[model samples]
Target: MKRGKKYVEAAKAIDRGTLYDVAEAVSLVKKTAVAKFDETIEAHIRTGCDGRHADQQIRGAVVLPHGTGKKVRILVFAKDAKADEAKAAGADYVGGEELIPKIQNENWFEFDVVVATPDMMGVVGRLGRVLGPKGLMPNPKAGTVTMDVTKAIQDIKAGKIEYRLDKTNIIHVPVGKASFTEEQLTDNFQTLIDAINKARPSAVKGQFLKSVTLTSTMGPGVKINPIKVM
Candidate 1:
């Protein structure tokens, strides 16, 4: 768990006890990105909900206003017209069960996102044991499992990202890159926060957002004021 010198230097810039405003946090994240390569900016939101409870689970997707800077490769699980639609909409790869072997035997996973048509879920189910753990398994709640292959592919290509609470109820997502303007990063951050707020489950009685932190790929986390975000 030894951090590099660059990371240690960057960590010194942030006040460990302070909760920064969204804009300030975004700016601090950009400033602390000392890596030679344009590092990706990520948001980590700790929520009060417990993922073990079905009713408290938080899972959904949102189209970042200033899309995630990384290019998203989409793998569509479809057949016939739907498959064609997916390709026409700029899907990186489109196929049905035939892909199972390529993925299983060859260990091929070139795509960043997985989209499957509702009818094709049966075929997709076979790969669940592999895809589920990787967070590649498409679900209806995330709009990855749907009949609208074209829309799904387009959205993903347009910087749409899915966010869901992990085992500890923290949702980690890429907001943008360090190369982006502070304004762009702020916009994407706000959009994501708004979406998460709207998705709050009625079952949660205490604070919905426990803590929100923004940081670059190799930088120290800058905590955001949860009250300000809410």
Candidate 2:
């Protein structure tokens, strides 16, 4: 595939062999984002742990100091008072039995995040086939499956993000929009890196963070020296 002019220029700006300092990487990534629209800046981290082992899996969430710069639509699965609570907490959509059919028969899916009270898991479970693949399922580990619907809704609305390993043992997360300042991006990046380091599984015998890279939506990646970032 032919690379776009902007991408080619951005690629040329990077030193492919050098692992830049985290702060320097963040700055370079921002400078290389030549998209007309405000592109999102993301961090892609490769870990030493093996994804094939359940005990070695590293998964968690964090509330970035600066929000993701995207609006989040939340669908809450609750009943009666719980449903009302979700709405009170700014959930975009709240429902019970009606939602099941809406999502099942009508193929309803106009939301970004989904939160559910523990009691409603049985109903939410029915949509697993649909929601699971999209990473929209409300899992307890991500704090989306809980009785505290209000807190859960508020937390997610306040820039909370979940990170989990893929089949390659890599975790990709949005740090912030490219429009954010270097300080804001650095804070968010460090916050995420700290969270990942803190969640290190005992099974990871080697360096927990094998590699870290920062990039914008359409820019070439800037590799970060893991030692400097840690």
Candidate 3:
């Protein structure tokens, strides 16, 4: 893949061999962010655990302190009062069984996040094969499947993000936008790091966080001292 001019310039400014502190890494990310639009900044963490094991899987959600600078398009699978509650709580779309056919046939997937009431899980379960790979399926562990439709939508709108390990044992999570201040990004970084640290399973014994990289959508990644990130 050929590097874009702007990206090349940005890469030149970073010392690829250096492992910067979280604060300094964040600053470099912002400085190198040359996207015309407000691009999201994310942290990609490589963990020591084996993602192939169920107990070793790193998966959970957290509400960023500064919030991810993006509006989430929410879809709730609920019925009656719960549906009403979801709509009132700022859900962009709410539905029940009718949603099944829509998703099945029309490919009605214009939403970013999907939340479902516990009772609706069976209904939501039918769409698992469709939604799971997309990372849109609501899971209880991620707080996306719950009885409290209102709080679920509210928290999501407030920047609640789910971080799950990929097949490579790496977790990629957006911390904030490049336009956010270093302090705000740092706070989000701290929250995410703490959450990952807490989610660490006791089964394994190596360096929990093998590596951490922070970067904007179009910027070069800045390696952070993984030990210090905690």
Q: What tens digits encode model 3's per-residue C-alpha lDDT throughout 94-123? A: 998888988989998999999999899999
Q: Model 1: per-residue lDDT, tens digit, 1-230?
A: 99999999889889999999998899899999999999999999999998899999999999998889888889999999999999899998999999999998898999999999989999999998888989999999999999998888878878899999999899999999999999999999999999999999999989999999998988999999999999
- Residue pairs clashing in model 2 are none
How large is the C-alpha RMSD of every model relative to the true structure? 0.9, 1.1, 0.9
Output the TM-score of candidate 1: 0.98
- Relative to the true structure, candidate 2 has a C-alpha RMSD (angstroms) of 1.1
Each prediction's TM-score versus the true structure:
0.98, 0.96, 0.98
Clashes of 3: 0
Alpha-carbon lDDT of model 1: 0.93
Q: How many collisions between residues are there in candidate 1?
A: 0
Candidate 2, run of 10 with poorest lDDT? 96-105
